[model samples]
Structures are given as structure tokens and as C-alpha cells.
Target: MSDARRPNPSNEIMRRKWVRQLRDALLLPPALLYVIIEEIFWNGATALLRQIARTWPVRALQKQLMALPAPVILPLFLVPEILSHIGGFWAAYLVTRGEWAAAMVAGIVIKGSATLMVVWIYQSCERKLLSIRWFAVVHRQALRGRDWVLEKIRPGKELALRLLRRSRAGIIRRFAAIRQVLAARLGFRRRS
Candidate 1:
């Protein structure tokens, strides 16, 4: 058999192992950062949203939103997102004017509220919105992109989650101690 035609199972396996290690080396730090940010920020927002979703008015609004047709849903979805960008830009202008606290408040109030609205409406009317061909295509593309990122970061995500699980109890205990100390310092009595 020619050298080029010879089977090389061991070499092929080694090459794959090397490639995987290299990929992990390159992607692990960013993946860990992504995990931390998602846990800290997105989880909090999602928890708050879940609480809001249980309210009577929000439930009624969700029902009304779900009844919307694809055409109406498209504008409803896009408008909030556009307004959010405008709010973000206004926040940036405030920053440029040295209005630090105003910028922070605007960012949290306007952009944050708009984000909640967009997420709520999207969750409410997702099926109706996806009935539109273009919207469905875009949604599919976004999902594919998300899937690709998740796949690339799978190993890192697993490691981060494992470490987080191991550290969680310690973190909670430390936070509880700190909270107690702060409360005592602030003259707040513990409720036995």
C-alpha cells in the first residue's frame, strides 16, 4: 500500500484530540465569562419577569397579545426594540454631558424597561410572529447562531457549571454572613 493510502487510526485520533484541546484553550475563558454574566444578569431578569408574568394584568395582556396576527405582531415586536435603541442613545448622550447618575438611571429605567417589554411581548406572541415567513427565517438563523455558540462553548460551560455548583454553598454562606454584619452595623435587628 502507498504511504498516503495507509490507514492511520491512531494519528487521526490524536489529531482530533489536539484540535479539541486547542479549541477549548481558545474558547474557555470567554465561555466562562458568558456563563457568569448570564447567571448574574439574565437569570435575575428572567426571575423578575417570571414574577411579573404571574400578575393578573400581565396574564390578560399576554392573552391579548397572543391573539394578535402576524402582521400586527411584527410591528409590536419591532417598535419596542427600536424605542429601546433610542433610549440607549439618549442615555449615551447623558453620559457625554457628564450626567453620570442621570445616564445610569436612564439606562436602567428606559433601556431596561424596554428590554423587559420586548422580552414579554416576544414570549407572548412568539407563535404568531413566527407565522410570518421572513420572521421565521430570521428566527431560525438566530437559533442556529445560538446553537453554534453553545456547541463551541459546551466544554467550558460544563466546567463552569461544575465549579459553580461546588462553590455555591460557600458563596451563599459568605453572603449570609456579610448580610448579617451589614444589618447589625446599620442597626437592623434580626427577626429571631
Candidate 2:
């Protein structure tokens, strides 16, 4: 076999061992932390909201509000998301005060309140909020702006992807060249 095509068992084993160590030492802990955070904050909040929505009074109010016109009810749908964002910032502020436990409690409470508000608005209005004239105008303008921005950035994104691919290929080629030079040096030394 040509030297380029020959498989080096030692290199393969070393590479596998290095990858295993990297994964165990560097990758696993961060991945586990991310999953835990997602489950606790996102999934837990969703479950809480679902449970609250099942109550009788909230359900009745939702039904009543849902029967109303879209323009009249549209403003209510915006409250929860805005409040939740504000609450998140507030929780972060609390954390800076060294009140980690209180920060967590505040975050949960704020999220729960926001989720409840959202659920109530959503159950009552559905997609009717989009039908409001002023809201529709703003939504359309926002979409147009987004499209314009994307169009402008599309060339830059493609350039970045192209550069990244080229850089990766160049690095691989350089590594192969270095490996060949090292192997040649080692083989000459062994023969001598």
C-alpha cells in the first residue's frame, strides 16, 4: 500500500483515546448542566401553567374573553411575554444581590404569573389578536423589516460559511502534511 493510504494503528488508537478523554473531561458536564436547566426552568414552568389552566374560574373567564372581538382583546395577549422578560431581568438583579434562593423563587413566581396571564389571553383570544388593524399593520411592517435584514445579510452569511469550510479543509491538509513529515522523521530515526 502507498504510505498515504496506509492505516496507522497507533495513531487511530491515540485519536480514539484523546476523543474519549475530551468528551469525558470537557463535554459531559456542560451538556448535563444545560439539560437540567432546560428541564427545571422551561418544562417545570409549562407544567405549572397547564395545571393552573385546569382550574374552573380561569377556564370560565377564558371562554368569556374568547367570545369577544379580536381588536378589543388583542392588547391583553401582549402583557405576559413583556412581563416575563422584565421579571427575568429582575431575577438576575436579585441574583447579583447574593440572594440565589430568593432569586430562584422570584423567577418561578414571575414566570408562573406571566404564564398564567399568557394562558388566559391565548385561551380567550386565540389568533384573533393578529386581526386587529393597528397590530396587523405593525406585524406586516416588522415582517418586511426582517425580510429586508435577512436579504442584506444573506451574502455575508454565505461568505462566512464558505470561509469556514475552506479554513477547515486547509487545517486538515496542514495537519496531514505535518503528520507525514513526523512519520518520515521517525521512520528514518528507527532505520539509523
Candidate 3:
């Protein structure tokens, strides 16, 4: 190759760095979203559902759901997931149309409902659904992806938690001040 045609090490290094930067920038939004969805919505909703599921009526319903066959259980497991995608698409469309408040409300309601249903059904019918080989494979892959994302975002998560912990007292004081101001404006004086 001629001198001009030869690859340059410095240029290659710079290009790689630029590519890395671009890749990280692109990945950050989705990674943060996954973290938020998993940590906030999924965990909280699932925990609440789990408590509800422990009630006698819910337990009876779950027992009936678990008795369902594998084929039936598959669709039951999938419908909520499909609804989730549709809801997400609708929410994105709302955002594109500049309906910010509506989009936020719709996204939360749709996503939260779908998440609760999916978690509830999955927890109830786990064994039956897992009996299907294809589902088991997909479930395993989904779990692996979750683990990978969590691992990738671990540093950011730690940093956020650390900052929140450090700011906890300040945040409480600010909230207290805001409450006092609001209460005074509303003519609700403190008895003490």
C-alpha cells in the first residue's frame, strides 16, 4: 500500500474512541429506562401484587390459574406482554404528538396495568408456562438480558443511591419548608 493509503494508528485510536462514545450515548437512554422500569415499576408493583396474591380469594384464583394447561397458560402469559408493547407504542405516539401530560398518565396507567397483570399471571402460572420448552428458552434469555443490563448499569445505580443517601436530610428539610409554606398559605396553622 502507498503511504497515503496506509492505515494510521492515531486515526484508528481516535475513531475507536469516537465510536465508543457514540455507542455509550445511544445506549444510555435505554439502559436508564430499563433500570427505572425494573427497579421502580416492576419491583414495587410485583411486591404489592405478591402481597395481594397472598389473600385467600387471590390464592384461590391463582390455584385455578395454575391448574390451567400449558397451551392455555402460554397465551395467558403472552397477552399482557403484547398489551405492554401496544401500550408503549401508544405512549410513544402521544409523546410525538406533544401530549406530554396525557402521555405520562397513559404510559403509567397502561404500562403499570400490563406489568401487574403479567407479573401476577407469571407468578401464578410459572410452572405450567415453564413446562413449554420454547417459553423456558425465551424466559431464560430474557433473564440473561436483564442480568446483563443490570450489570452494565451497576455503577450508575450505585452512584445514584449514594447521592440520594447523602442528600436525604437536605431533601427532607426542603420538603418540610415547602409544606410549611403551603400550609401557611392554605391557612392551616400548626397546633404546636
Candidate 4:
């Protein structure tokens, strides 16, 4: 290739950097929202558990639950978590069917129910749950499956990045124009 037609290595690096930054900026809002929702759920669940634990009947039940073997108590602990996951999948199905209100209600109900179940499990049989061999095996297998799926999807992610890079300049210009229009409408003077 002629020197004039050659791609500059530094420019390639800069383009990659810009794309990564843009991707991060675009993703930040949703990631932050997820973190906020998770925090709210965790705190709310903990508070509810504390309130529940103060009841004499629940404390007595917890004492009885604590005496059970891991094999017996593990099923009780796992059942609620499995049901919550099923409810979430059902909500997703409802969303696909365009039942937005029903999906929202299902999501809320599942979360609330799951929170209570988890709190009860923790309060009642935390040690027994941890001691279950089959539970640990299942958890590890699920993690492995998640990692495998993510690995499989990585090539598609790279193809998307490549397409985005090819169109980067046009997208940047469109966004710049939008910024200028908004600045003008808001009576802000553009710096040269």
C-alpha cells in the first residue's frame, strides 16, 4: 500500500478508545439503575427480616428449623428461590405477550415474595443451607453455564463493535449537531 493510503496505528488506537468510552457512557445509566434497584431490594429485605425476627412465634419456629438436618432443610430453602426464578421468567413471558401491566404486577409480586422467602431461610436455617452438598454442586454448575453462554456470545459482541466503529464518525457528527441545536434552543452561546 502507498504511504498515503496506509492507516495510522495511533489513529486506530484512538478510535478504539473513543468507542470504548462511548459504550461505557451509553451503558452507565442502566448499570447504575440496576445497582440502585439491587440495593433497595437488599436493604428492604434486611429490614423486613429484622422486623419478622422480633416476633416470638417466628423466633420459636427458627429454633425448630435450626435443629433440622441439611438434607431436610435444603429443599425448603431452595423451593422459594426456584419459584421466584419461575415467576421472573413468567413475567418476561408476559412482557413478550405485551401484557405490560400484568408483567409489572408479576415482577413486583415475585420480588416481594422472594424477599420474604430468602429472609425466612436466612433466619431459620442459614447454617443448614450452607452445609448442603447438592446445593453447592448445583450453584457451581449454574455459574459454569452462565460463563459458557457469555463466552459463546462474545463473537457477536465483537461483530457489533466492528459495525459501530465503521459508522462512528457519522454517529458522532449527528450527536454534535443535536447538542448544538439543544444549546441554541436553551440560549447557550457555543464556544468557538
Q: Top model by lDDT, which number?
A: 3
Instruction: List model 2 lDDT by residue over 8-125, tens digit each.
Output: 9999999999998786567545444433343455555554456556678868877888888886686676777677667777777898999999888877788557756765575456
The superposed Cα distance between candidate 1 and the true structure at residue 173, in angstroms, equals 4.8
Clashing pairs in model 3, backbone N/Cα/C closer than 3 A: none
Best by TM-score: 3
lDDT (C-alpha) at residue 173 in model 1:
94
Sequence-dependent TM-score of model 3: 0.72
> Which model, 3 or 4, shows the larger lDDT?
3
Report the Cα lDDT for residue 107, model 3: 74
- Give the runs in model 4 whose Cα sits over 4 Å from its true position: 1-40, 137-192
**Candidate 3 global lDDT:** 0.81
lDDT of 2 at 180: 70
| Displacement of the residue 116 alpha carbon in candidate 3, Å | 0.8
Task: Give TM-scores for every candidate, taking all chains together and pairing residue i with residue i.
Answer: 0.58, 0.44, 0.72, 0.50
**Predicted candidate 1 versus true structure: per-residue lDDT over 1-192, tens digit per residue:** 998999799999999999998997887665554444334434555655786787799899888888877898888888877776676777778989999999888877876777677778777777788888998998899576556667777887799889988999998899889867966775554467
Greater TM-score among 2 and 3 belongs to 3
How far off is residue 167 in model 1, in Å?
1.7
Error of 2 at 139 (Å): 7.5
Better of 1 and 3 by TM-score: 3
